[model samples]
Target: MSPSLLAALLYAALTLLLLMTIAALRATLVITRQRTADAFTPAGDDVSPFSGRLCRAHANCCENLPVFGVLVVTAALSGHADITDPTALWVVAARVGQTVTHLGSGRRRAIRLRFLFMLVQIALLTTWAARLLWGAMQ
Candidate 1:
């Protein structure tokens, strides 16, 4: 198969992986929320990880995944995979960073690293999209 086709398939696979991660995160948040709500007391604080802006965080992450996926797919479909290596590497690195953050030590540190990785991933994807658009216009 052609390089472009392979790149497209890889991007699609990454998108699916993102979807699956979102689903799992949602489920975990739901359980956490339910437990917190059920255990609420008159004098005690419901210190649930799911209570403070986690839904928004998850939503934001989900939003970016599709944007990245679309850009990568479009570039690959437009015969731009040769130029897509940098973006693909960025995506892969971001994924690895995310996994490490999720499974590594230091919650605060992990959170910051994950956010940075996501930002880098978004930037890479946006750059790829802009390049593809410029090429199309040429």
Candidate 2:
């Protein structure tokens, strides 16, 4: 029930989420590349996702992981264990939104919602970190 424990849990969850997202993104890239090449064969046809700038889905997830992990650890060390439950929930929500955004049919909407959730989660975590630091300085 301690804040530190909660923070640890959150950190673990965040790490797992980031790893899963990276795996999914890599798989998508591999599949797309294979299909593209196959379609371009002499007797094959063009069949692939639209050709354009690569999606940043996995990159974004990786980028956020460090921030989330650091905040959780900082909060735990600062004795703000009370914020763990909510922080973990927010992290879960953000991960859900991320998955949807990455693979859902309505990508634009999903991405928007995912980003919004991510912002909310980050704000909550930042607040927790600040509180922990403030408490330590007091």
lDDT of 2 by residue, 1-138 (tens): 654455456546655665564446455756767543323322111222321112344355556667666766666665565655455666656755664555454467766876787777677777866776678889
* lDDT, each prediction: 0.59, 0.56
Q: What is the TM-score of candidate 1?
A: 0.55
Give the per-residue lDDT digits (tens) of candidate 1, residues 1-138: 544345556555655664565456545756867443345332222433442233334344455657655766677677787667645765766755664464453478778987887777767777777888899999
Could you tell me the TM-score of candidate 2?
Answer: 0.58
Point out where model 1 deviates above 4 Å.
Answer: 1-61, 99-107
lDDT at position 109, candidate 1: 79
- TM-score per candidate: 0.55, 0.58
Each model's total of backbone clashes: 0, 1
Query: Which pairs clash (backbone N, Cα, C closer than 3 Å) in model 2?
Result: 3-81
Model 1, residue 103: distance off in Å is 6.2
